[model samples]
Target: MRAMVVAAVVIALAAASPVLAETVACHLTYGGETQVIESAPLASPYAGTPTAIGSFFLFRIIFVREPADLARINLYVYAHAEFGEAPTPVQHASYPYPVSNHGRYGFTGLQRVYEPKHESELQYWCEMRGA
Candidate 1:
């Protein structure tokens, strides 16, 4: 009976623990382009300044691939506004476990929360990093 209990406890523990899988290719679409970012380190085409969008800026769009039967992806979106001075982060949001049925996802129309007083340019970028 004791042996059986021990075996049951071991089985339970094993089931409770999550299994880590190898990193896979994940794609992020921003600024009319799609780039591949691995699960190892964050990677993106927009490494430097953020891209421009009218008077607002797109900070970044990062996608982290998850270990699931389907193409489950975690999407991270960030945006900021600049008014001649240093840029300030306006928005930061995350969508967890977004299933990518077509192996692709796109996000747009990120409205800037802060409005600049004078004529300013909006900058943005995208990146992919480890989950």
Candidate 2:
């Protein structure tokens, strides 16, 4: 009976603990190809790096989990040249914590962005799992 009580207490504590592991996966589609980028929430927004997509775009997703009120996710898309020219910011999207998923699921739905110079289209959607 004592062992059973201890086991119950342990289970209760575990259930009350906060979820420290979360994954935010983004599906990126461009130029007839698709790519997925998965990331866990970071303590700092500056910890993320951009990934090159094809010859014209650099994409980045940053998830920051701080205080409950301050948690957020930011997506950045940049227009980049294969040459030595600098990358120019094209699109930026910010989603606050507990994103607007009415009842469907964790998916945030499809979002379309465009590059200013070439007017190229980039499509992406993101799903968040865990807390």
Candidate 3:
């Protein structure tokens, strides 16, 4: 039936959508002079305690507006920080950025975000406003 076909199409769209949640808790940490981001807004940012989630699929940083000011940022997991830097964003808008899974240690939903060059990693990102 036409109705059945429509239902299938809807289901397909949902599957294609990126899975996510609201308010992703990004743990920012830095102490050494190079720790705090050097730019406008605020100075000297540090890490916060990890947040707990019962269960979910995956978590990523959905920037309301990507942080183009960030010189470097580190994703915390397994007591290790992966260093990353943003290279002058050509444009500014909301975009989804993926957070790699670190086995048992990972957060779900959109938590953190920073500017990326030419948005080469966009495919891995999800929708910021909603999952």
Candidate 4:
């Protein structure tokens, strides 16, 4: 019984480790269709540019602050839409954060994107700061 409990604890810690390692997070949503994101893009330490969209349905990202971080959470979004001419983004939001940055902080995020018109060739890039 003790061994099973310990194993469960180990798995929980392993799952939470990734959130502690990151400083930025994001969320993206589309109006329709389900989609899949290939990998997590690193916004710091290295430059990331995901600009390749082909036969895409929908892709989005969402982020939240880990309880341990104890800092303001920020989110970023990068997406491309498909269309006869070009997918026009309908809206953009600039939400506010409650407190100031705690210096060393991290975030976790996911994205949802959609490409109905083109259904192909939908890609983009974005970042966030001072959540």
State the lDDT of candidate 3 residue by residue for 1-131, as single tens digits: 99999999999999998875433333332221111111121222343332211111111222332354542223322221224732232222232343333433232333333223221211111211223
- Ten residues in a row with the worst lDDT in model 3? 32-41
Query: Could you list the CA RMSD of all candidates, in the order they appear?
Result: 11.1, 3.7, 16.2, 11.4
lDDT of 4 by residue, 12-39 (tens): 9998775533323322223333233333
Error (Å) of candidate 1 at residue 102 is 14
- On a 0 to 100 scale, what is the lDDT of residue 23 in model 1? 41
Which model scores highest in TM-score? 2
- Model 2, range 9-128, lDDT digits (tens) per residue? 999999999866677888899998999988888888889899988777889988887877878988898988647888898888888976655333245578787877777888888888
Model 1 whole-model lDDT (C-alpha atoms): 0.41
Q: For every model shown, what is its TM-score relative to the native structure?
A: 0.31, 0.76, 0.23, 0.23
Tens-place lDDT per residue, model 1, 55-125, is 34443434444333333333332334345665556555544444222312232222223334543433222
* Residue 127 lDDT, candidate 3, scale 0-100: 19
Against the true structure, candidate 3 reaches a TM-score of 0.23
Model 1, C-alpha of 70: deviation from truth (Å): 16
Q: Can you rank all candidates by lDDT, best first?
A: 2, 1, 4, 3
- Which stretches in model 3 have alpha-carbon errors above 4 Å? 21-24, 27-29, 32-131
Tell me how far candidate 3 lies from the true structure as C-alpha RMSD in angstroms: 16.2
The residue ranges of model 4 lying beyond 4 angstroms of the native Cα positions read: 1-22, 27-84, 97-131
| Candidate number with greatest lDDT | 2
